[model samples]
Target: MNGNRFGRLFQVTTYGESHGEAMGVTVSGCPAGLELSEEDIQRELDRRKPGQSMITTSRGEPDEVVINSGLQDGYTTGTPIGMVIQNKDARSGKYEPYVTAPRPSHGDFTYSAKFGTRNWGGGGRSSARETVNWVAAGAIAGKILDQHGIQVKAHVNQIGDIEAPPVSFEEMLEHTEENEVRCAHPPTAEKMRERIDQYQQEGDSIGGSIYFEARGVPRGLGAPRFDSFPARLGQAMFSIPATTSVEYGLGKEAREWTGKDRNEDWEFDAEGDPIPEGNKHGGLQGGITTGQPIYGEATWHAPTSIPKQQKTVDWETGEEKEIQVVGRHDPVLPPRAVPVVEAMLSLTILDFMLLGGRINPDRLDGTAGEYDTEYHPSSPDNE
Candidate 1:
């Protein structure tokens, strides 16, 4: 409940439940005078909305976004931006059985233990549907970062045991959206799709990882130890429902190598700036960015919700039961999670950028007492 808010300077507080009437977010600390529209946020929401493709859920929510505050004539006013997306497809009947039985591997039991009671419909605040708010807030952060040439992108790199070959950032941007799996490799995406279909047909689910990258991020945007870039990034990724592990740079593979093999030596770019000979460090050095592309992977466990019959104890009756979690659910998560990953990345980097003084926190143009921003509305008297 207390943790619904995220960020320090650039903050977002999300509200509403999975089966609630609507989901919404309030974003504060964004600089004033940036051009933002409902369409900008809606575009990102569309990517993560339910029922998008065969691999996704069958729910038919359109995920339409409406910006209700914090703008004037299409420009941000440096105040809190409020946006809402209504839940039009919620069906609670199927979820009723699990209200007392507690779904396996889900937050149901824990939520009840903590709150003494829960919404129990569509998993309430714990459902992945809550991520819709994150995608919306990230869209605004993406717009803020866009003005500074910072680009964030992500792709499904692995589904179950089918791992995609490493891809370039350009490939991720160009080919990620081409397939239902959202993998950059076309042939691999086909394989992933087929694999997902196999699981869907079996009434089961699978897990996977997402490879995310941020380009044009400045160095020294993070502090050592606690407030480090990777630390914050890890928190953001792990907060997503079902995320099991997160790793940066060489990640878990580095454990097999000696220090010499893992260490990245320093070199100079054409501009004479210090750079790394290799990016094994994943664009981060000692918790601060190295002015190189920050890249990593976040792994999600198989979704807990499955039609396959699962066993659990009925807390109220003290009896055991087998239940089929039949409802609209995704067989695999990474495809729809792609935008959520990007949104968190954008939000994290933009917050750091503002904290590092790389961008003006008061105005997008970095100039105080000036209404001359490119996004500012102009009078038609001259026309």
Candidate 2:
């Protein structure tokens, strides 16, 4: 419960359970005068909300976020922004069967082992449902980034065994939201949607990877060692449930690649200004931004609480049994998790931006301008 906070300068502390009265976040360190509205946050929530498509969970929670505090006249007030979304659709009755029967690949057993008890009602804090908090906070953080032309986006690159062919990030942005699977490739989206539909009928789930990218980040936003941009990004990303793999800048495959193949030199643009010729470094060099497009991929395992009969031990009777988990769950995760990944990235990037003094903080005393340096992506030298 004490570890619910993320970030140091631009902090976000979330509260509420999976089946609790409501889920919400307290966004601290956001500067005043930023135009923040409920609708702005709601737009991101709709992308993350359930029942949007047949491939995702069937549970229909409006996920309507209400800004409880820190706003006046649709603008931030330099206070802790409190936002909450009521969970009117939580059907806690369906989880009675899992009271003592922990599902595989879920946080059930590990949570119980660590806390001496677990909220079997929708996996409690371990549920991906909690990711909505991050999305909301990310919306705010992204708003800050938007002022500087920094943007984050993600798309489903694979589903189960099907992988999307090479697609341009521009094309991905243009077409990612056009499909229900949130993929850029139309042919691949159809295949992924079909695969997820098949899994849904079989009462199972599927997992896949998402390629994420962030553009317009300025250089030198992270510390050298522990607070490295990638390190902080990893901490924020793995917080989501079932994230099995996270690879950046060649990731684990770099071990098999030679320096000649992996190394990419900074090329001068037509303007005689330096620009990244390639993304072999994923826009990051030694845990810091390089003013190029930041790209990476995160893979999530299949949902754990599937309806298919699975073998588990009933702690109540200490007997082995097969039980079909009953609850609202997604057949495929990566499709819906695309926004979640981008949201976490946004939060991480914004936090680093604040930490590195790239942006000014909110001051109640009307003293706010604290320019750190002239390091900007759009600096005349880079432009």
Best by lDDT: 1
Q: Which stretches of candidate 1 lie over 4 Å from their true place?
A: 368-383
Candidate 2 ranges beyond 4 A from true positions: 266-277, 363-383
- Estimated TM-score for each candidate: 0.95, 0.92
lDDT of each: 0.90, 0.85
Record all residue pairs in model 1 with backbone atoms less than 3 Å apart, i.e. clashing.
none
Clashing pairs in 2: none
Error (Å) of candidate 2 at residue 328 is 1.8
Worst window of 10 by summed lDDT in candidate 1: 374-383
Query: What local lDDT score does residue 4 receive in model 1, on the 0 to 100 scale?
Result: 88
Residues 1-383, candidate 2: write the lDDT tens digits.
46788877777989888888999999988888899899999999999999998777888899999999999998899899999999988888988777787777677778888888877788788888998999999999988888878988899999999999978879888999999999999999999889988888888888899999998998788867887888988998888888987888788888999888887877887778787778788888888888888889999988887887789898779999888887778887887788889889999998787767777765423455664533344643222
* Model 2 residue 41 distance off true place after TM-score fit, in angstroms: 0.4
lDDT of 1 by residue, 223-294 (tens): 899789999998999999989999988899988989998887888899999888988888999899999999
